[model samples]
Structure formats: structure tokens, C-alpha cells
Target: MSRKRKETEVFSLSFLDCICCGFGAVLLLFVLTASRKADQMDDLQSKIMAVIGDMEYEISLKDKEIERKKATLAVETRLAKDSGARLDETKKRRTELEDMLKLLLQQLAAIEGELGKLIDEKENMPTQEEKVPIPIPNPDRRQYLTGFDILGNQVLFLVEASGGMTADTLVDAAEWADKPEKERREAPKWKRVKKALKWMIANLKEGSNYKIIFFNKELVPLEVGFGRDWFDPMDPDLTVEVLNAIDDITPEGGANLEKAFAIVNELPIEPDRLVLICDGLPTLSDSYAGGGNQVMYDDRVAMLRAAQNALKLNLPVNTIMYPLMPDPGSAVHYWRLANSSDGSMISPSEGWPDI
Candidate 1:
């Protein structure tokens, strides 16, 4: 009944409970360690994935760079090919030019040999017709000008095919202007001018090229057909064609010397020398002046303009002045033109054939 004190026992429930609690704490510690290890592994895996993504991005940039380099290489190769083609073309052209030069040299040698033979034949036994060696007014090895001493490889004839060419006086010029084409064609002065032209053509060298331009109010070429500007007098058929063409032409318009010289300015290739066979100063400039004691002031002004234009050609202007009776001033102006341009003035005696 005392039950005052519970006796201390060696094995008690409290002690057992303490042992069990210690065991539970050990199990909890083991689980926490396993969880911590798993968490560390996950973090390492995330870092590795990020590194792989960066490496993939670098590889993509490298591929793009390689593509760009390939494109640049392709362009360079194309340019190189184009340059090679141009070089090949240049070489071919050079070869062709060399061949042409060789051919030209051979031809020149042959021509020289023929010329020597002609000289020998001419010296040894002159023919009856060759006895009076055509008096070349200004004999030169390079050219055969109609009236002047100047020589040239190429020659142009600027003939005044105007109504004034048919007569010696303005009254007659007006009268002839009213005449029919058939009658005007047979004028005495016109015939003489034509004869002189024939003589010049006959005396030209066999291979010489010439062009005849007739200017009145406008310019008229000897041959208007395509590819037929210069004439070869050596060809008998061509000579007849030119002669007939001249015969067909009739003097009817007022003389326009300005237009005549302007034709020279417009030539595709300038001649070495020019022979202007004009009667007087310009009567018709860009416009016409009625025949009534022709104004000399305007004529001189127009002639000055023509002379200045002619000077631009930088070649000798061998003037063959026709006697336009009352105008000695014309002769003076022509002389000044010749002197300024380093040319000669030849006034044929009386008529055309006299020269």
C-alpha cells in the first residue's frame, strides 16, 4: 500500500524509446545525404547542356564563314577566266596587225621597183606625145595641184558651179540665170572651166584619189552614191562617169563661197590640200541677195568668215581665181587667204586651157 517510490529498473521503456529515436535520426541522415548527391548531379547535367548549346552555335557560325569564302573564291575564279579571254583576243589582234604590216611592206617594195622601171624608160626613149612633158605648174613629188605649187597626198576641188560662172558680168549672170538648163550647160566660160578640170584629171597620177565638190547655194558632191566619194581618174569608165556628171550639171544659182568652204569643214577626212576654183566672193550666204550692183561690203564680210573657216583646216588652200571682171578686191582677198594658209595663187591666163 506504500507505493511511495517506483524502483529504478535496468531495462526501462524510456531508455528503449531513446535508443529507437537515435536509430530514426541515423536513417533520416542517410536519406538527406542521398538527396543532396542527386541534387548535385542534376546541377552538373544542366551546366553540361548549356556548354553543348554554345558549342553548336559556334559550329553554325563557322559553316556560314566557310560559305562566304567559297562565294568569294568563285567570283575571283570568274574574273580570272574573263581576263584570260581578253588577253587571248589581244594576242590574236596583234598577230593580225603584224601580218598586215608584212603584206604592206611587200607591196611597197613592188611599187618602188615598178617606179624605177618607169623612170628608166622615160629617160631612155621618150615617146612623141611625152616630148612636151606636161608643164606641171608647181611640180612636186608628193602632189599635182591644179593651179598652186603646194603638194598633197589627198586633193579636194571646191568648184564654183554658180550662175556667175556662165558670164563675165552681173547683167549676164542674171540673164544666164533665167536661161534653160540645156543652154546654160554650153556657156563658153563654163566649157573652158570643164576643159581645165579635164586637163587636171588627165595629169593626176594613176593611183591618186580626188573629190570634186560644186557649191552654189549649196554643196554638191561628184558622186552621191554610197561608198563613192573619191574618184580614180585612171579608170576610163569612172572618168567618163564623172565627166558626164559634170556635163549634166547646169549653173543656175547664186555663188555661196561660205557654203563651199563649209563643205570642207564637214569632210569626214580632211585632204592634204584644197583647190578652190571660185570666180568671186560670196553673193549668197545662208540667204540670197538679188543681183543689183552686188553689195561688196557684205561680200567681203562673208569672204572673211569663209577664210577664217578655211584656216581651221590647217592645210594649204591653193586658190585658182577666175576673172570676175569688176572685182580686183576678190583677187586681193584670195591672195591674203593663200598667203595666210601657206598656199599659192594661180590666175590662169585669159581662159581655162591657157594654164
Candidate 2:
């Protein structure tokens, strides 16, 4: 009983106060630490957000730059493709132009060759000496024949009536040979030839005996009765009759100079002077009867020799040559013949005779 009275109060007031104070201090410290930690967490979160935003912005800029680069590359590629296509077109065009240039050069060379041939032919032409004019009754009327001398009393005119007389060139003659007879008669070359013949007849010595023989494949006189006879140049109606007869004739055959010379040789009176009016060398001869249309140069030369031999009389031969295509040898041959025969050769201009 005495021990229980001594230890009655086990938990005192002071001890309780000390425990509460300790609990209160612990709660205050906990609140202060939690507030500080919350503030620090908020600051750290803001900094992280700022860093993420900067990184995202940097990534967006990089994407934009890459897009720009891609666009630029696309444009460059298109330009490169266009440039390549243009280069290809230019190469093709250049090749075409080169081909055209080559063709033009070839044509130019051909033309130059032809021109050179012409120049050579012209340079090799024969030269003639000037002669004194023969006195005539009416010199004013026959002024065109001032330099031309009719030396012989008995003159024979051998006119060519071949188809080549209708045109200035063989090509034209061949083209016009199939035309109507009226057209051939109206040809400019034929008309000029007739005028030349008339001029020649008008300029013959007065009272001189003359014969006009037109020959092609066959010999033809002004009239059948005049075949072997000479015509009186003093006849007033003779020129008109001859002109009328010539007007009625149409050139249609190849020339046969050998036959013409043979006919002249058979004349009743031997001619002292022979006037040959021809366009080219003979294309027809007795030896060339079975020959084709094309006459070689050698064959034509042979025919010319034959024709020359046909004339038995040693008479002067005067040649009046007209233009003929591809007959470059004709001029030289005729010139030599005229020179050898002591006669003159004339290649009249288009404006000759002035009629």
C-alpha cells in the first residue's frame, strides 16, 4: 500500500507539452521543405520547356531549308533536261545544214566546170583577117555587105533546110521537131535564116548568075526546073519568088552535106564560089544510112571529109554558121575549110542584116 501511493502519476504535464512542441516543430519543417521543393520543380520544368521549344524551332528551320534545296534541285534538273533537248535539236539542225551546203557545193562545181569548158572553147576560136569591100552599084542599099566580097561570077548558095535550122540549139531543135509545120516556119531562128538568105541574094553582084539550092536529106532547088541551072540576079521578080518559096518550106529533115556537094558537082555550070549556110556538121550521109540517131564525133568527122571530097571543083567556099548545141568542132572545121578554100566564114549576130 505504501509503494502505490508514492508512484501515482506516470505521464506528467511537462512531458506532454514537450512531446507536442516536438510534433509542431516537425510539421512546420516539413511544410517549409515541401514548399521550397515545389518551387524548384516549377523552375526546372520551365527551363526544360524552353529547351524543347528551341530544339523544335531549330528542326522546323532545318526542314524549311531542306524543302528550299529540294525545290532548287528540281528547277535545276528541269533546266538541265531542257538544255539537253535543245542541244540535241541544234546538232540535228546543224547536220541538215551541212548536207544542204554539200549539195550546193557540188552544184557550184558542176556549173564552174561548164563555164570553164565554154571559156576554153571561146579561146580556141579562129581569127579572121579584114578584107577590102567590093564596089557595088548602090552602096547605100547594100551597106550591110560592106566587108563581104562576092568575088565570083558564078556563085552557088547551098542552104541547109534541116530541122536544126528551126532552133538555135540541138536540144531546142529536137524539142521543136515534132511541132506543127506552121510553128516551125514561124520560129525565130528560121525567120532569121530566111532574112539572111534574102540579104545574101540582094547583095549579089549585079547581072551575076547565081543558084540557090536548099538541101536536107535530099537536094531541093527553088523550082524543079532550076535544079541544074543558074538564076539571073538581075530578075526583078526572082527575089519575091524565092522568098515565097522559102516561106512555104518547113524544116523537117537531117542535113546531108555530101548529097548537097554531089548535087553541086553535077551542076551544068561549075560554080566559082560556093556559099554554105549550115547550122552544124552533116548528120546524114550515104555511109551513115544504117546508123542510129546518135552520131559519134569521129563518124561526123568522117562524114564531113566525105562531103568535102564530094566537091570536085576547087572553088572558094564561104560558110555562114548558125548556133548549134554540142557542136564545138563545127566552128573549127568550117573555119579551116573556109581558110583552105580562100574564102571567109561568118557567124552573124542576132541583129545582123537589120531587117
The numbered model that scores best in lDDT is: 2
Q: Write the per-residue lDDT of candidate 2 for residues 1-355, one digit (tens) a residue.
A: 5665566565799888999999999999999999999999999999999999999999999999999999999999999999999899677656645554564476568769999999999789787675787777744224224344465689888989899998888789988899999999998898999888876676677768887888999988876234424676556445445556778888878889999988877887888878899998888887555345677877777888889888888877888899677788888998888767667778889887564
Candidate 2's TM-score reads 0.56
- Put down candidate 1 lDDT per residue, 1-355, tens digits, no spaces: 6668868898799989999999999999999998999999999999999999999999999999999999999999999999999889667656645554464476568769999999998789855654556665544422223445423457788888888889787787778878889999998778877767765665566667788998887788889345587887666556656776888888777667767776687788778878788787777665344345655656655655654674467777777777666767778777877777767777777655542
Cα lDDT of all candidates, in order?
0.74, 0.79
* Runs of candidate 2 exceeding 4 Å displacement: 1-147, 224-229, 288-293
RMSD of each: 15.7, 25.6
TM-score of 1: 0.55
TM-score of each: 0.55, 0.56
In model 1, which regions exceed 4 Å deviation?
Answer: 1-147, 224-227, 287-294
